[model samples]
Every structure is written in structure tokens, then in C-alpha cells.
Target: MTELLTVDGTQSALSQRYSSALMNTFGAPKRVLVRGEGAYLWDADGNKYLDLLGGLAVNCLGHAHPFVVSAVTSQLATLGHVSNFFASAPQIALAEKLLGLFDAPGKVFFTNSGTEANEAAFKITRRTGRTKIVSTVGAFHGRSMGALAVTWKPAYRELFAPLPGDVEFVPYGDAEALAAAVDDETAAVVLEPIQGENGVVVPPAGYLQAARRITSEHGALLWIDEIQTGIGRTGTWFAFEAEGITPDLVTVAKGLGAGIPIGACIGLGAAADLLQPGNHGTTFGGNPVAAIAGLAVLTVIERDGLLAQVNAVGNHLASSIIALDHRLIAGVRGRGLLLAIELTQPVSDQVAQLALEAGFVINNPIPNALRLAPPYILSKADADSFVAALPGLLDQVEAG
Candidate 1:
């Protein structure tokens, strides 16, 4: 054990050291997780916890997946990172693989994370010679300066003054509002098929189709941010796939590389060649290790047929929660492995706390929402275990 975590009474010591050494951005650490396997995690105190949040929807294949581990390690040993200055086979292959997922001819720009992917998309929008962007209410794109400007949280936006301007916010799921807000001179209309960070808030049917129509009519780009809902997290190759609408820009990350840091901003058709040479570049965007990890993840997902499994297990998890007939539960939302348990009362924080104490790792995204984006490999039994314990956790919150 390292000195930071090996001190007497691990939790308290680690907590103090963490506060002193790191900036307090995400408040105190929830738990110093030491190890993870599939859907389970072990903390520094030797407490085992069932991970239902899946690293905030990042770990689609679960923690320490053997295939991803093997691919990344093998690539590292052979040809680690030959910067963008030199082309590598794995990098080219991964890019080709991602583009093949779409029916239309497209090009991809690689990045290190979802936010950077969105940032690249933002720059692509600028190439259209338009300045205005219309996003939606309750959309969580990412936290970087450019992505945060489009994100619709006052708490996040208020602190960061004078963000990139001309960004507009309209009511989510409102076709009229979207159509009205987007007009000529609009660079892009960014949206998520389902707002994952906003407690898995899914939009109305035909929403994406309407968005496509409106943006197309106005000659504005339809940029869909699939950071949380892509990579089979929503039971499809991408959450937007079912809409049958091809977006101009699609930014994907999170589960794309399983747990590895990788993301891509894909441009289809005319939007593909907007960024010219010297327009944008990345130092560690398409490194071989991360590329292999992404390739391995995509390969495993296909070989194991986890997309079908995601739908089955996800449906079972949602249905089981509803069957519990708990008074606190308002309903369930979202599709595939990304789901939210809506509570009748604003006690999600308390319930999540209780759940953590009960050896379950859940997330309270909002006051009345518990978000669950477990791994695609999560078994029905693993989901059932959480459902079995949920009532008691809610009861503890109600008793107070």
C-alpha cells in the first residue's frame, strides 16, 4: 500500500491527505476504491459495494475488463503512443471502425474525452461561419468551457462568467420551441437523445426527427452529443440510431473505450471536411493504447452480443423496480442500461446515502432522481440484488 492509503485507519487518513493534496472540485471523495471486477467494487476500508452507476456511465464493460486490459497492455508494450505526428495502424483501424458504424460516408476526429469531442464539434460549427447555437433545457453536454456554455445548468454556468456567447436554451422535448429558436444564422442545434446527466430524462417520440427537419430547413447543423447514451449504453450502437436521422456532428465517448480515455467527433457528408489542416490537433487523441482499447471494446461488445443483453437486463431491472410497488417510487425512465428511478419525494440524496451504507453504489443526480447506468455486462441477478434491497433503503429515508 502506498503511504497515502496505507496509513492507520485508512479512510480518515486518506481523506485528510486527499483534501490537502488535491483541489476540492467534486467535494470529498465518496470512497477510495481499491479494486473492481464486473459490477462490484471494493473500497479502501475493505467494504464491498455493488456499482450501479458504472463510473457515471463510463465503464460499459465494467471494471478491469480482461479483454480491454489485454489489448491496451499489448499495444503499450508494442507501440505505445506515436503522437499524431506519425500514423499508427490501430489508430487508423479504430477510426475506420467507428465510421463504419454509420451508413453515410464520414470522417472522425479523435479526442481524449467526451468534453474534448464536444469541443471539436463546437469548432466544426464555427467553420460554418455561423455564431449562434441552440441547445435544450436540462441538457448536460460536458463541463469544458465550450461544452459548458451549451449545458443548461444555472449553478454550473453562473460561476463561469461570460461563456462563449450566442448560445440559446429552449425547453427540452418541445418541438415548437426548438423549431422557433433555430433559424437562419444558427450554427448548430445540440441535443442528447436522452439527457443522461439530467436523471435519464428521455425526450418525446419524433423529437429527433423534428430536430432534424427544423435544423435542415434552417441550414444549421444537428450535433447530437451521445457521450452518455452511446456505445451501446442505450441498447443500440448509438441512442440516436433508432431515429433514422443522420446528424451532421455526433460526439461520442464514455463507453466508447470502455474505461479507457477515448472519444470521437464524427462529421458526416458535407460537415466532414470543414476542419482543414492547422485547424485543430490533439497530442494524445488517437494513441495506439487507447485505440486498441476502443477496438477491443467494440469487438467484445459485438462478439458477446451485449447490445441484446443490455436491452433484456435493462428491461428486467426497470420492471422489477416498478413491481416492488414502493410508495416512494414515482416511475422509471430511460432505456437500456442507463435508467433513473424517479421518487415521489425529494429524498434521493438520503436514499443514495442509505444505499451506499448498504453496500450499493448509486447516484442521486437530482433531488428526486436516482440514476443507474450500470455496465452492459451487468447480469439479471446483479440487477435483482439491487432491486431486492431498494425498498428497505427507501424506507430508511421515509422513516426519518
Candidate 2:
């Protein structure tokens, strides 16, 4: 047995050691998290924090929930890892379950993460024999080469020059530009039902319908990147449901396994047959453990009526934050639990840091935008507490 290091522990020393050993992608660690339960987390220093970002929208049911834990443990005990040559019941069940959420029948390709799921969709689009793909400006699909080709930001794409070419970018909400961009050679048009990475920018009404009409006219596949907006995070099973359009392909992850790594690309209608057998596969993609976790999450979401809860709490939080009328808060933009509070000044990063010090965890993706993706189980009292603390937090940021 390993001996106990120390009561207080050498967490800082260990963190520095980790910095030396690990890659410098995310910069320095932010007070290494030791443990989590429900919406609260404890750092290595043993200070508790209310986690509002929900691990970047992965922990939908919250941390260490019994259902997720039990499902994972039970599946591991029964049958852990299997090669892609063999199929598992949980994987097949997950595929069927996902397809059921859509009115149209589809096929599923499981992947280990969002980028990989998108990679699968990328290949599917290629099979259409059209190389050009029309994407939106300010879109964040994924970081890998294929997904990166469709992402619009130059900082992320410029370094990796000569990416798979023929990706066209149009203004996100302008149907005219999108319509003007799509031609017969366009394989697909990709969009996030709600642009989560760009400060939760919701498109105008009929924007997606316009996309549907345009894609239909050009025979292009309509792909929805629901990676951050799916699995009841947006008060619906999928954000595209709100748009009232049937997409040819839908990529989902983030909250699929409630923290477990799992992503899926679902192809609907004729697009379902595009990827034949032997086209793509992954060893860990559809493993029984991840599938079990997904099953548990879906079951719980259904049984507890969490979607309704997300709508109610999200509306309450958005309304409350807007009512604060603080100078920093310009507006609250987003749907359901995926909300962002826009600040008048570009001090969102400062506000986030202060909020953390004040025992609240949040995310600041853009300079003047703070994202809040709290768990679907966020209590009304917890929501109120966060709303109550926002004004003071903004004041402190401004003072600094």
C-alpha cells in the first residue's frame, strides 16, 4: 500500500511537477481539482467551489452521480473492452435510442470525442462525391484537421495551412449569403443550431429553415453540430428540434455520457447509407462502458423530466441576471441552460476569475462574454445565489 503523503498534501509541488511533465496546451493548471460531488468541487487546497460551467457542459447529471457510476461499474464488470470486430448490445441500443429521438431513421457512427464524430461526418460528406462544404463564420466544429477545415476562425486554422480545401464560409445568420454560396458541387452545409463557442449566438428565426431550403435546392446535406447543444442541455432532446428542420447529419457529444468520453454522428435519410461497412471504426468508440453510461444518462433524463427543469431554471436565471441591470451586464443571450451574460466592457475574463475566488466556477470564452452551462439539476436556490452574486462580482471586476 502507498503511504499517505501529508495531511495538507504537496499539491502545489505536485502541480508544478505536472506542469513540467505535461504539454503546455492549456497553460498553468487552475488549482488542481481534487474531488467533486453534485455541483460543488474541492480544489487541492480543500477550498469548495460551486461549479457553474459543468466541466464545459460534459457533466449534465452532475459529478459522481450514482446512476453514471453504477452503469459504468456494472458494464465494466460484465464486459469491459472489445474489438470493433465484435458488436455490443449497449452500442446497438445507443444507436437505436439516438435514432428514435429524430423523426427520420438514421445510422450511427460512434467516436471517442466530438472531433472524431465530426471526422466521421466529414467522410460521409466526401462520399457524396462533392468536395466543397459550406460552413458559417464564427463556427467551432472541432480542432482536428477535417473539422478544422470547416471552422472559420483564422487563429485556429491559419497555422495549419493547405487544409482540405473547398470550404466556404458565409455570415452565420444571413440566409442570402448561405443561399448564394451553395452550388451543385457543395457537399454539405454545416452549422451549430446554437453557436455555443461564439458566446452562445442564437440565430434569427427561419435561419435554419432557410438553410434547409438552400441545401434542398442544391442537393447539399444539412449537417447540424449539436455537440454542445444536445442531450437535453438546451431544454430539448436536440437544439435542431426547436428549428423544425430535419438535418442530414447530426454530430453529438459533450453531455452524451455525462462526463464520459463519447460522441456520435447520426446520418439521416439517404445520407445514412453513404458510409458503408469497413469505411470507419474505433476500438474505444462504442465500448460497452461508455454506452452504458450514455444509456443511464438518457434513462435518468427521461425519468426525472430534466428537460423541463432545464427550461424553467434557465429562464429563471436569465431573467434574474437581466433584472440585475448592472452596468457590466449588457444582455443575457442563449437558450435553456446554455446561457451567456454579455458584459458592456471586455472584462469577462476578470469577472470569471473574481467569481472563482468568490467560490463560483464559470467560463469566459470571449472577452466580453461569460458562459454559464450549469447542470440540469441546478437548484432554484443555487440559481438565485448565483444571480445574487453577479452584481458584486461585476463591481469587483470594474474596481480592479
The Cα RMSD of model 1 versus the native structure comes to: 1.6
Q: Which stretches of candidate 1 lie over 4 Å from their true place?
A: 1-9
Residue pairs with backbone overlap in model 1: none
Per-residue lDDT tens digits of candidate 2, residues 95-162?
99999999998899999899999999999999999999999999999999999999989999999998
Count clashing residue pairs in model 2: 0
Model 1 CA lDDT for position 272:
99
Rate residue 379 of model 1 by lDDT: 95
Candidate 1: tens digits of C-alpha lDDT, residues 1-400: 5566443558777888789999999899988888899889998789999899999998999999999999998999999888788999999999999999998999999999999999999999999999999999999988899999999999999999789999999999999999999989899999999998788899999999999999999999999999999989989999998889999999999898888899999999999999998999999998999899999999999999999999999999999999999999999999999999999999989999899999999999999999999989999998999999999998888899
10 residues in a row with least lDDT, candidate 1? 1-10
Every model's TM-score: 0.98, 0.97
Per-model CA lDDT versus the true structure: 0.93, 0.92
Worst lDDT run of 10 residues, candidate 2, spans: 3-12
